[model samples]
Target: MAHQGFPRGLRILTAGEYRHVFDNASFKVHGKGLLALACPNTLGHARVGLVFSKKNVRRAVDRNRLKRLTRESIRLGQHRLPAVDIVVLSKRGAGELDNDTVQRQLHGMWRRLEQEAKRHLAATQSIA
Candidate 1:
């Protein structure tokens, strides 16, 4: 069976890596309580970064929960995504949502991101 884990390879692990995506985001997918910035990459697979600040989430428990949900959402949907670096940021109201609500919003965001990435890839290919 294929390994089903959030391995290091799928994570954006450094300040510089996160900065690169923040500085050069090609597109954004916005959902209730969350916003995702994405830029195409050459890595042949998707990588994810997350930003859940204390200012937004207010509690460590809530922050952790958001991270878990985001990671799982990415893990399950990564194969359908194009090669891009994505950073998911939390908004002030995210911490108040129930798990089911958060998951539903996350799933929708992933679907939107995937569609956006496909269009970006197609456009770049045509331009090349």
Candidate 2:
């Protein structure tokens, strides 16, 4: 079986790395209570960053739950995702969502991001 761990390499560890995606995001995927901004990368795999603000989540426990869910969702779906740096931002209502609802929304967003990435790849390839 293929290893499906959320390794350090798959995480946006540094502030500089997160800033790179924030500044150069070319694709935006929005869901009910989440927003994912992504930019193409040359790393040949996808990476993710989470920004669950204290004001938005209101509790450390809630924030941690959201982050865990987000990481798990990304880990399972990473194979289908393109090589991009994705930063996921939680909105005010995100903490209220149930696990199932959050997972569904995340899956939908991933699909949208995949489509956008494919279109972008094709467009860029055609121009080159």
Candidate 3:
């Protein structure tokens, strides 16, 4: 089995980094329990930021679990994603979802982000 680690470089660690993506996101994908916003970056790999607020998921353990699942999904699908900075925000009631269901939703969100990224790039290129 291959080991795939989620390195610090592939994360949005600072508030500024999160704000930058939020302010300049070029594409967005909406899901039942998740929302993904993506912006192209000069870095040659995709990076991710997670926003799981207490207001949405009151329990610390539940929030942590969601973050873990999100990071795992992103790490697994990173190769398929473009070089963009992505922010995944959890909506209210996300903590109520089962692990398998959350995993499935994350997978779908990743695929949608990829498609949206491609479409955004194509549209920009055509306009230019």
Q: Rate the local accuracy (lDDT) of all candidates.
A: 0.90, 0.93, 0.89
- Which candidate, 2 or 3, would have the higher TM-score against the true structure? 2
Residues 1-128, model 2: lDDT tens digits: 98867899899999999999999999999999899999999999899999999888898988999999999998775549899999999998899999999999999999999999999999989999
Give stretches of model 2 more than 4 Å off: 1-4
Winning model by lDDT: 2
TM-score, candidate 2, is: 0.94
The lowest-lDDT stretch of 10 consecutive residues in candidate 2 is 74-83
Q: Which candidate gets the maximum TM-score versus the true structure?
A: 2
- lDDT (tens digit, per residue) of candidate 1 on 59-94: 999999999989988877544877899999999989
> In model 1, which runs have C-alpha deviations exceeding 4 angstroms?
1-4
User: Weakest 10 consecutive residues, lDDT, candidate 3?
Assistant: 72-81
Task: Kindly provide the TM-score of model 1 when superposed on the true structure, using C-alpha atoms.
Answer: 0.92
